[model samples]
Target chain A: MPAYVVGHKIPDSDSICSAIALSYLKNAIGEECVPARLGELSPETLFILDKFGFEQPELKLSYAGESLYIVDHSDRVQGPDDIDDATILGIIDHHKLGDITTSTPLECWIRPVGCTNTIIKMMYDFHGVEIPANIAGAMMCAILSDTVIFKSPTCTTADIKCVEALAEIAGIEDPQALGMEMFKVKSAVEGTPIRDLVLRDFKDFDMSGNKVGIGQLEVIDLAIFDEMKDDLHADLAALKEEGGRHSVMLLLTDIMKEGSEILVVSDDDDLTAKAYGKATTEGRVWIDGIMSRKKQVVPPLQDSFAG
Target chain B: MPAYVVGHKIPDSDSICSAIALSYLKNAIGEECVPARLGELSPETLFILDKFGFEQPELKLSYAGESLYIVDHSDRVQGPDDIDDATILGIIDHHKLGDITTSTPLECWIRPVGCTNTIIKMMYDFHGVEIPANIAGAMMCAILSDTVIFKSPTCTTADIKCVEALAEIAGIEDPQALGMEMFKVKSAVEGTPIRDLVLRDFKDFDMSGNKVGIGQLEVIDLAIFDEMKDDLHADLAALKEEGGRHSVMLLLTDIMKEGSEILVVSDDDDLTAKAYGKATTEGRVWIDGIMSRKKQVVPPLQDSFAG
Candidate 1:
């Protein structure tokens, strides 16, 4: 049976693009490879793939019981039964790895690069595989999405080299121009439901023994923030219920101001105070200068949790 | 006199974050620096800045006769009168330079990197400036916005280094996780006006002697694409009438699929057919593999225009 390349659950651009690019690269090197998605793709992912003229890979509910080649995400979240019968082939990712259970791994290449797309692009370039313009565009977007356009700590030299080479082929003089255009298009906020806005780009993090959810939404009208404040707070409270967590915090971030008003709704004032360096008796804390929940919020919470 | 760092018109994240980060770096290096915005920030940028706890830089409606340092945007667009008595000190940008008369000696640094935030981050690291978590998050978001999280081709090694180092300081384990969250938040589209959706992230390009306008919208639901088709067509037709000698195209792109249904609205069927490689009398071209207007759409149109 052909080895299948499986990405993390909720396949991201990095997972999908890397799988496609690397699968093609591996196939070119005479290896039977298949690109597989661990879950259904989001609309944004579908947009990117459609733009590049690539089909979303075959969706697999679980990587368990199949030969697995993982990308972006790790297998730590998967049950043992999921991968008990599966042979591990290799791993390629930009994220920190969790524990792996595969007994006989054929190859595991985990680089702290900005994007898995960069790695796949390098693999294709190293082997002299000609990437079509559309694939190049997809890979470029994947890299942009993964590294935050090379603003993340995960980016590597290899990632940059891959993007430079790809940029030349793609005929883009400025990626920022393209990105700005993309982001502007992506920022259409007029028609979305309040629930969708609240849940649109949300993530759950284990913070200080409590599952804390962080969500961010962008709006053109800052007045919209003022208008939506009450609704957003109610939504946060609802999210806490839905997530069954100790608290849920939403950052009503304004990109122009370069600052954020932290919206907190929780029972534990101590946790909020420790996490935000301030407390409110109203179960709400407004924090300034708080962005990068991963970098800023997560670390501090980890410290408090550990303490 | 303090050196004013001015960004381009219609300031994006790169322009705003780069201005602030670079100003801080310059101040650290014992230079008088002030961050300045050239225009009103877009809604997405406002979200980022507010999230990071920074005030939006003072907006300068017109740089008329003011000596200023340019970042992200070019000097040419500011017009001769705006830069008349202005001493152009330095320029840090990621775009191709248009024709501009430099009155004073300029230390223009134009790299093909993904974002000006990457450049600003590099300066911060080079000068050994400590990045606050807020600044780091802002820069990271800027990079994510500019490079589409490193999926754009314009990213460079410097961009990767800045992001990697910043990510570590910001304490983010995986920037992609954050990016995915951000993009998801950004992709929500429920109540946005069809006109606003069409123009939110719109750009114009000269393709094969025909000026072409391209717009993209990131919506959470795929059904919206189908729902808005008729409105979009009517809007495009109206847009064409109120335009110069050019065609308009919109990509209701599904990012997950990395593909797009390229909608072309043009009176010139020949130009449309040549650009899309097929002629449809309906004035709409469905391109299977076209994303990145710069790479996939613009170049082909440029070639066809030239031909």
Candidate 2:
């Protein structure tokens, strides 16, 4: 029977690239494996695939009735029947596992690296598999995408090693240049919808008993941020209504400004004000020097939410 | 003068992480440094920052009027005025450079690695900087994101090593698990507008002679795919119109199905039909065994576009 490689949800570059690269590696090893994508590829991911000349993975929106070699995602062992596989063949991922149990012993490789693409690359290297430039570029982009070009605190030394080797094969002297070009290609933000721009990279999380959605937008000009502020405010208000969350946060970060103007929309003005360090009459709060919401904002918010 | 840590646009995890990690490294060394995000953070990225306690880097959408440190991006000596910078203090990237001249002729660490984050991680390790667990998790996530969890063809030994080292520090036994969790957290995919979903990870590219936009959607259930297929189709058509691309492609990948139903929308029916081997007549095309677009679909599409 052919093995199926499935990535986690919201298939980011790593999820897509890992499935593809691993399938390639599995093929190299004489295993008939298929790369499977579990969700939609974001626009940023499309750019990476196009730059590297890779095909988007086949989308698998439903796993309710299928056999899959899981990659990058798994539900808790005791949780609801998220996955109904009797036996899990292999598991590869890099996140904290809740309660996972495999009835049939599985071959699972879970590393604490930034991207699954790195693991597939290592497997190929460990087995002496040669990589094409396009694949190399795709994987490179995946790593950069996941590691924040190696700025995120989650990066590991192994990720660095993989990047170095792949960079050589890709014939890239400055991976940053390639990354920059890829980013610039995406900077042509005209003609894009305001909602699309606002929700371009949005994520929803269950925070402090409230379903919260956070959206981020990146633009070259800080002035553009001001131009979009009013629209953004309206968007946040609409998103809050649509998302049905206690609060919805939008971080209008000016990379050049070296700070972020955080917009908070919520019915609980006190919570929003407390989160922003000031109360807003319009139930909106703006905070500065608040770039890392996870580090600087979420922690305090989590506390406030608890309080 | 304070040194600026510049990054690329549409900044990936590595781009942002490298900027932040490098800024931390520079600050440790007593250099006046600030980490600047060159572009926006994708939804996937915001989640990563949240997962590991880190703040998003200040968004720097454009390099038009700002001083730049030129991290992960550079311009040729004769490309355009936007490419030239008088205050380029340093450059840290992983791509190949084409004739770049720094006005100040400063330090340059241009490595052929999978991610710039890997290099910055090396700096932190070399300097014996104690990274917090949150920072470590962020770095590890960055590596996984960039390297596609070590599967991308671009992964290098250096990237692998960086991830491995950082994994130990981050206290993660399996990075793939972490990556999966991160991906799952991102893949909620409930109540998202069709346009937002399409553009979330969308990328625009000049393919052959035509501009194209490609988007990927990964899901755990194929059933949801069926439900969203029509909306997705409509969204693709709108994407083509709004983005003004000759073609807009959306990949509905069912990981469990081990196959993909590709939807291509374009004014030129022949282009769409030829790319997928046949047109389904619904302005859609279906392709089997089409996981690696880079390895499978793109080449044929490029040829067809050329033809």
Candidate 3:
């Protein structure tokens, strides 16, 4: 079977770009691999795809009977719908896993690094393939997006070093200027509907049996969310019911302020208070010095679901 | 968590010695790991351990909180009972896998090589650790056991080269004579009970969840099984009931003849006939030139179950 290199649901910049970069690396090593995505691309992901002159990967919902090389994430809930039926040829990820069992043995490299592309960079070196300039651009843009220009708590020294080397290969002398251009597209929200904005970077989680949804939007300012707070909360409520979610959370992050204004819609308010440990004034609270949803946000939500 | 390196149930010489060799290599590389077994040792395995002057690894049924580095097998039915609870740090196997899901990313290297010890040797060279004489002897013995001294169908060119290199390191002038000496203990069964002989190298298979048991005995002659056929059949019935097995097959292999006289105790007789495509007389059939049960026997049984 031909290998489909794919990322998890909610196609963030890192997931989409890393899938492309890894698929390129594997193809260079004589593997028949197709890069694919799991969900619709966010604006930041689209910006990277456009800059790298690549089309968005085909959105695949199920991959039964296919040979899969999963990247970016290995969580079962975020995998293709018929994941168990697929033959997992390999897995390369940097996240806490969900229970994904394969019928046969395969290659798996799960590390504690920041971005999946960092692992891909190491593979390119190992295989002695020089990263093409466009693929290097994709990797560099992904590291910047997932680590929030090294501001997110998940960023590691490996990420910092790899991004610099990739920048040199891609002929980008000023990575910070390119990052600002990418974030400018990320912060724009004039013509986009509020519901579309809320769903742009949405991710779902399964804690025990309870289904939870977390949506985050990074902007230079929080007043965009403040103006549409009521509409976004209403949309989140509808999304929770429509998606059969037990709770819904929105992390409106201000990159310049380096903080988040988290909005919650949970059946238990006390559980939310216990999770975040701050007063719920109008169902929102400020979290200082927090940017990583993977590190800071998901753990508390998982604990609250357990409680 | 400290790593617990384990082999499959029914600890054959290859499984036991490979686990010990892998644990040694990991310890040499600064990993805190303990070698473990899943069941009682076969006489052949005991012979190898005593020859190597090594104690038996701890028999472990379950390892809940420890990190696991599974070797020799990846079948969950043959792994620790609480396999899902343990953190899977790595996997090194040379078999078709069972459904084992880990909660985190890990290092997995599964190949179609002849033995797990072959893979361990590759890892030793990759890590620049020189295999000592005794340790190389253990790996050489395991390769001999698994490949049936290069006569089994599963034996590859890699296994032949690896065994020769290991023999040089192990200071064995004539490895063939050493293997014959080892086979002496394997064929000796004057005082061994009928049940103990049957259980000596028995292994179970899970074919789409149906439990199938295959027992093998390699003797210099088959006159022993011919005299004890009725008692062996009765004991197999008891073992099938006790183990909740769907079928039980005993392959009375003769080393001199290089073939097996198979005894069948299946719910479907036609399936067995179709699986082997051989005529049977009173539940016994002589198949010529069959040595490797994994390569030549189990595939047809799995297909019969599929039908």
Candidate 4:
């Protein structure tokens, strides 16, 4: 059977694009791999696929007893529900080292970078395989989305170089202009349900046995969330209760301002405040220069919860 | 301070050589890296180093508050005692996906190969750095020793190809002859103390909270250990009690015979028998075609313990 290349649930552009691109690379090297997704794609991801003239990957939820190549995330909580039952053949990720153990040896391409596609690009170069133009476009867009147009602190020199190389291959004249167009589509939260908005890029973390859910929504301006803070908090509280989570958080990120207005609904009062060393006013705190959740938010929250 | 690149405790040929080679590559890439060791070198490793005209690395015990780049192994139990206190910069290993999680992102070069030196050789190629003749010789010896002259089940095509390339660079015409010479040095056990013999190539694993200690001694003939089985078992029992380990076992591997005689001293009776599906006679069992402890032995023991 062909091995499945997949990404984490609640798929974002980087997660979706990397899975497709890596599966393409693997097939080029004579490995039969199919790109798959664990959940529905976000609007930004859809926009990227559409802009790059690519179709959405098949949604495959259950992975028991199947060979898998995981991309974008390594944490067990973010993976498929039956991930432990599956055989992980490899991993391509750009996150922290997670709590996954294997009985046998496996290939891993994990680096401290902004996007998984950057590493996939590196793999393509290493294998001397030329990436198709459409895949290159999608990969470039994914990097822009993850790094917030090279503004996130997680954006490294390697990521920027990969993006530049991908942009050349994709024939993109103005990546920043394309990035703005994608963020505009991502910012359309007017008709979106509060629950959908909160879970657009949500992830759950097991921090010392406490389940903490964090969501991020990046827009050109934070003012788009001004009228929905109360509804967002209500939905977050409901999500916390429904999932039996200790805390739920939403970061309304303003890409232009390079800051985030955080909304916290937690069993422990002042959990976010304690984690970031800032006082919360009515369950909300605005922090400047907090862009990457994997780099900045998750690590501090994990440390605080452990402490 | 320069980041220290060290291998696991109880330094083996692959561990010591890969640490030195990787540090050399990292320095060539304009990074300050130093080779170090957590324990004394085995006679096999010493022989390889002396033949390659290299010096032993400095022994460093504490890793608290220092930058580290781990080589050869990723298990927390195999690392320095204060590993949790240190900032892990990266890891290069050829084992299973271990339980080492990082708060920050780090580079990892893990593959399903025979030796860590093979991966280091790939890194050298990736960075466009040239491997020195002495380091190349040492690295080739490491791969030869770990793979048992390409006879172990863990050896892959990548390992053989790398050894061939390294042999050309090191001006060695017959690597198998050199491999035999190294095994002769590794087979020396008459003059060594029982504890020293049992702890030469030993490692510890935390399998579902059970601390398991395993050691392996590779020799050309099983007859070399026929007169010392009882002594080895006694020393293993004492080591188990001294370390408060759940079990301590040793593999007397006859490389020529392509098998191992396992000596088990466990708190729970018949644990090894149940793990390997073989009956134990007098705390020992000989299994044909069992060479790699990481690939063949530890996985089953981990499963049995978790089961």
Residue-wise C-alpha lDDT for candidate 2, range A1-307, written one tens digit per residue: 6667776555666777878877887888897887877556667778887767877777655545444566654433212244643335565665423224332224445455766777677567656788887788788877766665665445678777778778998888888666556555444456667777666656554454577767655333456555666777888889889868778877665434445566778767687566557665454454655554434555466556655
lDDT of 1 by residue, B1-307 (tens): 6777877655667778888887887778888889888666656677777777889998766666566667875535332336644666666766533334331123444445677777677566545688888789888888876666666544556666777777787778787667666666657655877777677666655443455677766433446577778888889877877767478887766555555676667766676577667665565565554445544565567556655
List, residue by residue over A1-307, the lDDT tens digit for candidate 1.
Answer: 6778877655667678888877887888888999887666655567778877898898766555567677764434422236645666666654433334332213434444677787677567556788878778878877765545555444567677777777777777776555544444445655666777666556555543567676765332345566667878898898899869877777665544434566777766687678667775555455655534444565566557657
Q: Assess every candidate by TM-score.
A: 0.45, 0.44, 0.79, 0.97
Best by DockQ: 4
lDDT of each: 0.65, 0.63, 0.81, 0.92
By lDDT, is 1 or 2 better? 1
Q: Per-residue CA lDDT of candidate 3, range A85-179, in tens?
A: 67787777777655565544356555567788887897787578999999999999998888788888888898999999999999999997898
Candidate 2 TM-score, C-alpha based: 0.44
Q: What share of the true interface contacts does candidate 1 keep?
A: 0.00
What DockQ would candidate 4 receive versus the native complex?
0.84
User: DockQ values for all predictions?
Assistant: 0.01, 0.01, 0.31, 0.84
Q: Which regions of candidate 2 deviate over 4 angstroms?
A: A1-10, A38-40, A69-91, A94-113, A125-130, A153-158, A219-222, A255-259, A270-307, B1-307
The candidate maximizing lDDT is 4
Q: What clash count does candidate 2 reach? A: 181
Considering just chain B, what TM-score does every model have? 0.80, 0.71, 0.96, 0.99
